[model samples]
Target: MSHPPMRRPPIFPITEAQLVSLFMQSFAFGVHALVFAVCMHRWFCRFQIAGLGTKSWPWMVVATSLFILGGVDVSLNLYDNIIAFVFFKRPGGADLQFETISNWINIVRSVLYFLVAMLSDAALIYRCWIVYAHWKPRWAVIVLPTLLWLGAIVCATVDVYYVSTLHKLATIPHEKTLRPYLFATYLMSLLLNFLVTGLIVYRMRALSKQTSSFIRQQRWNRLKTVSRIFMESALMYTLSVVISAVMEMISNDAFYGTTDVSVELAGIAFDLIIIRLWTENTREESRTITESFIMEPPPARPRLNSLGHYQLRFPPPPSRVSFAHSERGSVHTNISKVRRI
Candidate 1:
């Protein structure tokens, strides 16, 4: 996916374009690998914080699955490197043609890449549902995203079926069959990110509007960090997918190879956000715990007795008698209100 096949590398000497493309692949893969490690570490920290009993278990699963997919991509890259070096770059290599570049592993790698994207998007949709849970007619807000998720799944299934059964190398199941799948997957993913982030912002805004006290306002201010992270991450990932799709569409004809790694950016986007979230969330939690401990109420002390014995003490001598008058000069004295004079 990183390399576009508009022009082939030289048989005698590699062209500047080839070098650049190679560099791009290496750089993109490096970024992908680095982010994958970060995501795993950060998600594991979150897992520890969330515990098995909480709602974070599913998130951990999704993150781990994405990490696994990254590993698979690395493995595929390793094989691709071996093939490219052995079969493509050799002085008297095999024909510089389709069989030389394409392989069945490409199918596996592409499908897995798409699978990770689907998983990431699915998690975002789940987040949207969680955010909008208080909305009446719950189905109204979720139905569209739910349907979109289903469409993505159907597209993925078709992609897997077509890609997995490929007989020719460097080939796909007709564009008509593949376009809908790729289009739906990427488009839905972007929409899901936007929708989820929007819902979260709405909730935050609602809370801000309802906040009355200074303390609550401070809490909302702290939460603004969380909201900022959500917005930036969602926009980042959505934009990455859009750029990747656009580059692919444009480069399919020209094969610039510079921005072909945008697919890898998708995974990188999630890792960065999740890491920031884990960091910010933990910081907020620790702050709350510290505040609670500091503001805790003091313990009540027991009353003391007097007269050199264990007798309850009464301080006042009851010098003033109390009276209640109901719209009359005549006083209505209450004995219960009078103290010992």
Candidate 2:
């Protein structure tokens, strides 16, 4: 049997500069992940769970746990990205085959991140709705969350499709067409994330302004504060978005470095920061509620009102007043007679 012609080895085309950048990105991701995990855990334990106890302790626990899970999932992605950079380079073929096993690993990891991102987004959406709550249509509430969940699903689908296809792009030859589509998908997902967060902030402000009730206003202010934290956390991802856009323009590996390492790390950091903020605020809210109850006096009963003073027990009404003029006249007559004598 004739042996097949020896094929040229795949080139992993990269320079020392690119390797250095990738390493820097990996280091940044690792450090951020560790920091986030530690800080977020502390935050959840200290503030989030305890704070949530005021409104709905059970739900708060669920949300806090979910938030932590999301943080951890993203951290895992950062780790995977670092590993991929270390072992796999585009120019030089990695010892491990790209399509055979690596693709599967990436797919699984991406799925996890997808779930996490979706859950975090959903949690935020739920909280926003809670804050904006009133006589809103049932369908409206259902629709918003459903839409957000759909966005998450779409993002995950696109991520899986494109990331998995990346390995077979060489063999399939048609994979080049998918690149723009992949970019579009990522952009859409990012946009959705930004838009959803923006909506929450906007709604909170609007509700705050429209409400006439003092109680509602107080709640709205709390939501507004939370929204601010959320926005700040989101600002980190905004950097990621900008960096990713610039990278897309440059087509340089360094740009990729920003998205995978720096941006990811930054996003994780913001998440932990927000979690801490939420925890602190929750504790403060609970304290405020407790203190208010302790300080306020109970309403007095209506029966407590007396003619002269307020009392708890009922009292008889005052009797009518009568003049004592005859007695005064008799006393004056006796004094006049004595003076004449």
Candidate 3:
């Protein structure tokens, strides 16, 4: 008869660096979420109060909500540190069930990231509709929006595919060839974002050409506002790419935890930008309108006691005058004859 001994579990795989990153990521998310919420609230509430338009409000809300969801999603991932600290221990002391929860949290986070991307595309499309209302070049008005919608579909599909596949990879054994493609998919998304924004900028410029100076200026100002927001997103997108690319080159795991952080940072930054820019643009526009009203020339006062009829102010030159003398044969001769008689 022989006796068997139980085995002990391994130590946590996370390094001290990962722990620092997690804390930083959560802290950044908190700060970003606060700023974005403030900006979005101010913008949407302004429109709601103005009563002129509410269309942008709904889209803004949806977009901001996605960003909020994204922040929440990332924050949950940071919670993994706690789970690892608490539940993971020597063999038989901790349950594998928590690992399943962790995996699910990851899936949800990816989905939210995808949603945040989708909402950004949606917001851009809305902007295109606003700025490119007249950017009709044969069929752009129809085709542009269609392309935007299609881009959303494409982005969502790819993200879903990647997330689902990666999730399944954990359970089912598969060829390791698909790993790099996951990162490639991420690049495709960044490209989509960049393309959408560039198109908007081009169309804005084109649309500006067809408008009055004032409206054109307004649209250009809007362009700058939107561009700033897009730039924020762009910065995050680029950083995420760089980090992931470098991770790939060096075969490092730093990107695994940090990519999401990059995204969350970008989300918050963009959302705050959207809110602040929208609010500022609205105020600037309103001020422009108010100033126009204030500085408008007074209604030309009508001259009092004015002769309405058209009259020549000067007489014409006199023509040469000829008066002919007429002979007056009087009856004086008859009167003289009668007096003599």
Give the TM-scores of the predictions, in the order they appear: 0.67, 0.56, 0.64
RMSD of each: 13.6, 19.4, 23.9
Q: Candidate 1: where are CA atoms >4 Å away?
A: 1-54, 88-102, 159-181, 212-215, 251-263, 296-341
Model 2 clashes, total count: 7
Estimate, for each residue in 114-227, the C-alpha lDDT of model 2 and write its tens digit: 554555555555654554344256347436555756765775587577667655523111134434644654565566657767766676566545432423344445545655
Supply the TM-score for candidate 3. Answer: 0.64
Best by lDDT: 1
Q: Name the best candidate (by TM-score).
A: 1
Model 3 Cα shift for residue 70 (angstroms): 2.3
Collision count for each candidate, in order: 0, 7, 0
Q: Candidate 2 at 100: error in angstroms?
A: 9.7
Candidates in descending lDDT order: 1, 3, 2
